[model samples]
Target: MMEFRSVQGSLIEAEAARNRARETRMRRALQRILTAAEGVPGYAPMNWSDVAEVAREALDADRPAGSNR
Candidate 1:
């Protein structure tokens, strides 16, 4: 037999964790993008929106097909 228990915390905690993980992944992706960009000829400066778009694409590409996340 097994027992399940709940710890007291805001329901928002799970969402906060997910957001933190996503931010970490985005940061890593941004670092990789910047590193790769450094080697490109005539590389242009990247704005936050551009970086965000690329990061979102990278994150989406990492997800398995048919996943809602």
Candidate 2:
């Protein structure tokens, strides 16, 4: 049916948009890490695991308990 086709098309478009936004965020995060590490001594480039761990730590640090905002 035409209605079903329209819904499917919309879902596909939405998914594509989500994927693009995720990629943009990831690229920006990587750029930030690279910039932060630029002048540090004995520093090596990050791998995916390193990036994931750092991001997890950052997220955990930013969250506080007791009150929900």
TM-score of each: 0.48, 0.58
Top candidate, metric lDDT: 1
Which segments of candidate 2 are over 4 A away from where they belong? 40-54, 57-69
* Tens digits of lDDT, candidate 2, 1-69: 999999999999998997786666666666657855684555566767877776665444434665453
How high a TM-score does candidate 2 get? 0.58
Q: Find the 10 residues in a row with the least total lDDT in model 2.
A: 60-69
Deviation (Å) of 55 in candidate 2: 2.6
Candidate 1, backbone clash total: 0
The positional error of residue 47 in candidate 1, measured at the CA in angstroms, is 18
lDDT of each: 0.71, 0.68
